[model samples]
Target: MTTAIYWFRNDLRLKDNPSLMQACMAADQLLPVYVHLPNLEQETPWGFQRMGQHRKIFLDQSLQELRSELRDFGSDLVEVPGDVLDVFEKLRAQIDADVIYCEQIQAPEELEQVALLRNAGFKINPVWQSSMLDSQSLPFQMQEMPDVFTQFRQQIEKNKFRFAYPVDHLKSIPPLPAIDISSTQSLGRNTISTGGKFQGGEQSAHTHIQQYFERRLPDTYKQTRNQLIGMDYSSKFSPWLAQGCCSARTIAKQLSEYEICCGENEGTYWLWFELLWRDYFRFLHFKYGKKLYSPKGLSKHLGNEFDSEHFFKWSSGNTGESLIDAGMRELKKTGYLSNRMRQIVASYWIYDMKGDWQAGAAWFESQLIDYDVYSNQGNWLYIAGKGTDPRGGRPFNVAKQTLDHDPDEVYRKMWLT
Candidate 1:
């Protein structure tokens, strides 16, 4: 009988997962696995744990939930800790698996993992399913896609391109291959839910999106999305999206139905617009791969010097600028931040503090529970003026932002005082 392994990466959920479906199709028996990589605990050059407590706790919860979901389907999930390559090596030998199937991740590090496994002679297939729109459906070749966000969005609209409809949920998955491996472990089974007002799981993700639309949240999304505080200000989809607990296509599909039911307006259009921007960032990796990670990204200019003292203060929220400090503190405490706060603090680091943009990005990577590699890198480069944007860096005036977003000092008082 054919045996194969289905590896789980960021794409945690089974619904709308074409990769998982492919593994089931190709194998008579299969093993599903999620490896907690060793690199997560390693310290970065910026001097902090690469993965913070909040993200780690949320991941444990997601894995535990996925484990429970798999059991219900008569398949089991293996949660183990090791270098991904090593974990797979042990599993392949133990099960005598013929091939591995997983969702594709286009970032440099994730790309390297696939390369290493292939070099080891494992027949690995990495399917692309993270973005809202399918690359195949786009008007232009991914390599030839537009360099700017506006141009990309225009082409998509001009060609009438929209998100691919989500696939039907699986009725039954292939039974697990009988095997005993010493490397396998269960999820830490953390009781803590997702950071601050969020819960981590496929069920939770679906529930949150269901309620988000049921309440007609999209009607006011554009107007309230920029607000500094409150759970209802925005869609709050990023945390689940980042974890792959729910597919972007699922969210967009719900949105299309919502638009149909409620009629399209600026708010609905803007939410679609934001999802499109997420796709734009993901597509960028195809046009420019490793360069996007470099300090001077696509430009001749060099990067900023790293200042350990100031970076410590800035990240710790001891910078003494009330607004910047408040935002940073919120981020560290909650492992989440609003898009507006993210931009303001990122700008402050690059332009005002004269800090290295890469360090700032690394710190965000270390902290954010909802962090996605593509969006984090793309946004930081945008703020640092190192990316493709025609306008240079964005430097927010703290006083003006304070006056505009938190004029009453209510937000400041909560986080600062």
Candidate 2:
């Protein structure tokens, strides 16, 4: 009787999960688990809850739906409260599972988790399934991939490479092991927000994309993607994508079909382009790894020093720069921010405020429901001129940003009041 543990990482949904499917095929009895990392409960170096209320509430919502889906498969999701090793050690004692299966995360910390588990005599399998394009299918080896975004996109287009298609959802998960999940292990009650702009889960993700396409939003994505306010202006798909409620392949496939039926235009092409950008960041991690997390990043330039006072003002929406303040407030309150506004606010923090980019990124990490580690780190490094393209850094003029994106003060007024 084979018993194996299937650990849920960022890839929360069962649909299109190759790793989960592998576990089902290999094991007779499966124990599905999601570890609520203990670190999230603590404070960051910048002095804020590592995981803020907005993100925690969204994650709980995602886990709730995942649990329901697993129940439908005659299995249950055991929410364990601890770090990877502690959680797995306890599970091993309970079930004596044969192996562990999970989606591979290329980030340093996640990689370290897997390494530690393997060193401790755990048989682990980590599958790489997060990006729209599989790393193996890229035109060049990951290490040799272009440093510039345009070069990466050109290679993809030049070779006519497209997205990896999503797989079907498992009809049934393997039955649970005989061992029962103790009630003591639960991560408390699942957080349910009274009302919020974003709800996280597989069902919510699919419903959102269905409507987004049905409304023909892609037709205008290029034009409206840069808008400062309103959901209709952008895809608004990041929150779900970040949490792995939806896979990039699923979105890309839907986009391809949308193009075939509705006819591809600048809008459709641009959406795909954005997806490529996301893939670029993911692949870059393969080459750079922990260096991306460094204060100097890939460059020799020393990053700015942290000023607690400036950080407070910028993060709390009290910076007195109307545009930056409004964006910060929206992110803190709604856990969502327009992409255009993100670059603007980040630029302001790095340049005008002369603040530490690492602190700025940490604040975003704390607040954004849509925060993906790769993109968050990559973008902050880009703006601070500490990344691969660290050519003098990206410094946006607050005056120009204000005039260009929020001249009407409509966005500013909406949040400031």
lDDT leader: 1
- Expressed as tens digits, the lDDT of each residue in 236-270 for candidate 1 is 99988998999999999999999899999989999
TM-score of 1: 0.98
Clashing pairs in 2: none
- Tens-digit lDDT track for model 2 on 184-268? 2544444556135778899999999999999999999999999988779999889889999999999999999999999999999
TM-scores of the models, in the given order?
0.98, 0.97
Model 1 alpha-carbon drift over 4 Å, by segment: 181-183, 187-195
Candidate 1 has an lDDT of: 0.89
Model 2 residue 291 lDDT score: 93
TM-score for predicted model 2 compared with the true structure: 0.97
Q: What is the C-alpha lDDT of each candidate?
A: 0.89, 0.88
